[model samples]
Target: MTDEEPTRSAPPEAHAVSPRFAEYTDRLLFGEVWQRPGLSMRDKSMLTCSVLIALNRSQYLSFHARRALDNGLSPRELSEIVTQLAVYCGWPMASAAVSELAPVYAERGIGAEDVAPEPVPPLDADPGMELRRKAVLDASIGAVSPDLARYSNELLFGDLWLHPELAPRDRSLVTLAAIWAMGLQPLLDYQYRRAFDNGVTRDEISDALVHCAFYVGWPRAMAAAMVAREVLVGDDGEDHA
Candidate 1:
């Protein structure tokens, strides 16, 4: 006992976390969730922006609007998300969200340079992609009406989707979220599938829906979850990557 040191205390006992809740977090919330191998946080941000706008959840949109900035999302990208939703989600909702975000932009002192520049698509891009896309539109619209098909293809695919500034993944994520936010479950289903084709993964797409849930509601989250499960299981077995 001359100069013997006291024994160190054992590490704190590991408390048992609820398996039910743990499963929810691990399987539904975190596990492979949002961990789609190649997806980036920025891509998720674009999806969040579109869904929030579509659902008219300006409050959460305002919060994530800042989060997006912190995560390196550019003003231009945010602007595009809001603008793109304007056509589908409506102008009033997008405008309101913009108003909410104005103060955040001011707080961060984001200037012109931090803003995302307009994107440009390759001139020699594949023309066949358009025809293939119509297949998606036709599947979504079916025999009900041509308007939805035209809008999805001509406006969403033709104009906004072609922007080179934003990657196809970003466009797909945003479009899928917008469909979910608008309560267009059928369209959401198709877009969610298409998103995977455009290089988005189930994990990334699910997280976007989760982020959207913070703004929208549980219903939309469930809808996104359903889609994520289907896609993750390789039902389509197609990869946009």
Candidate 2:
């Protein structure tokens, strides 16, 4: 907010565009919503960057990537985040993020070692989780594209999700942000529950979708929220008859 700190703020020229918007951004968005309890600044930064990366908003993403690193996302963790996003958000968006963030990483003196990561041990095995995942994929896509199912099971979830650079909770958060940004309704349905299974709290999930709105837009965020509600509360036992 000062000359000494590269704070998150509206551009100085933003006033010329719309003083009202700039004021709301500074006062309402940053001052209030970002400070909301339960979500740490670091996690919020991670979520924000994930949404931007999913939407391919490279301009804002590069700016926020700087803050994300300062907010405790390591170069390796950020790299892994982009890698995970590749599947859900597509290779092009993730590739573009890598291109844009390269210089930002350089400015921070991030060496090759900083982004090089090793896979960790497998998740403590859970038969239920495995079965549920396979069943859902089989029911949804296996009928049409068995290859996609096999790869999603063997490569995407089996290999990629176990990368140690990013924790499971962070993976769920990043994935949710990306899927929500793209308005992938089916993925949102499952990811909301995946997030909960990974220990992301309900409040955190709500906050994440809310954070995603700024970058991905309201319609997408709203659709994500509706799916989250269905997953969390389950039609509220309302009448279907």
Candidate 3:
């Protein structure tokens, strides 16, 4: 099949179990939500795979892994995503995602030789940029864990974020999806702001939250909305997008 075709196929029994739900899945979720204009299918697929990975939903994760490949995400990009999430989500969850995607990669003939190494920026890449990134991390979570603050600077923003395989905007989207799906509001709030800083527009963030509502659940989405609202409106009540 061509890369454009969806890798997932609904089973006939799905329609038999609940016609209405099945219709919604096929017609609305896949047809409408997946076809939305604001986000490309590649972005949507990235979000889907990340959400499923965060939730530890192996079945759906496998499906979306194939779909991500079909939607134009290279195996190397997917590998980098897993590696990046290892820090944000957890090593176990990230490892599980990699295990689940192994067969999918094998199917596509993407072996270890084909997977690109994660890029490492030079130590002197930009001292000013590194300082700014450290300052942001310190401001956000430094009080809680100085080690975490250091890790965030050295690993997350320093290394993973600098990887050219996925654009910063797309990386922000995936990060947002993973945290939102896992219902981590404080981290979600932090990520939402970081997302905006990384070029994820307010409307795109809102759309992402809404899209996640279907997969992650309404309660979490609502909580995320409240956080977004608070972020958009500063302490002085000014809308800051």
Candidate 4:
């Protein structure tokens, strides 16, 4: 499928239960939020899949897995996203996402070999990586745990973030979605800002959280919206000052 095509199909039965919800889902979520020009379909797909994976919403993952492919996310990129989430979310959640996508991959002729991640280059190859890592750690938690800081730098930022299959912007979107789904406010607050730093605009972040409400539930999305608003407002204040 081409990138311009709609990744997700319409519900088989419209107004099957609640017409209001179906209309909202069809008109607002899909029509407006997803169609918002700030974020690409690929970006939205990655964000949606990451949230679904983090929440262990396996039933919905299959549809998104197929959608992700249509949206131009490679199988390898999707696999790497699951791998990254294993560390950030949990092993079981990531594992379930993989299991949920297996059939979709098979149907598309994406074998295990096709989805295997490429070898990550050494950290030194990206000279600025350490500097960026230290800046983030210093700003957020002050790197209180030596081991954790090392892991975050050498593994999370060094490897996963640097993975060539996905751009840093895409990685930031995925990370934000996972943290939001889990309701980790501190991380959500940090990641929301990080998302902006990684090139996700404030409006895109807002739209993404609204899109997530349907899949991850309203409570988590509402909580995340507050964090996003705070981060954006703080940014605006800084710009004005």
Each model's TM-score? Answer: 0.65, 0.89, 0.84, 0.78
Candidate 2 residue-wise lDDT, 1-241, digit = tens: 2223223477788767998788767765776667777778889899999988888887788888988888888889889989998887889998999899988988889989888876456666467888888998989889999999999998888888877788999999998888887778876777776777788888888777777687778998888888777787776665211
Decoy 1 TM-score against native: 0.65
**Model 1 ranges off by over 4 Å:** 1-45, 111-125, 135-151, 209-215, 228-241
- In candidate 4, the residue pairs with backbone N, CA or C atoms under 3 Å apart (3 or more residues apart, or in different chains) clash, namely none
What does candidate 4's lDDT look like per residue over 107-198, in tens digits? 99998789766677632334574687577786665547767777776678767776777677778888888888888987776676666767
What is the lDDT of every predicted structure here?
0.66, 0.81, 0.79, 0.77
- How many angstroms is residue 188 displaced in model 1 relative to the true structure, after the best TM-score fit? 2.6
Q: Give me the displacement of residue 189 in model 4, in angstroms.
A: 3.4
CA shift of 125, model 3, Å: 7.4
Candidate 2 matches the true fold with a TM-score of 0.89
* Tens-place lDDT digits, model 1, residues 1-241: 1223322221223114454444444444333434444556666566667766777778777767876877778787787677667777788997998898888888888766665655454323357867876885688674577887887777766777666666677767777777777767756655766677677766666566656674457887787677666656556676433
Off by over 4 Å in 4: 1-19, 119-146
Q: Which pairs clash in model 1?
A: 76-116, 119-165, 120-164, 199-240
Can you rank all candidates by TM-score, best first?
2, 3, 4, 1
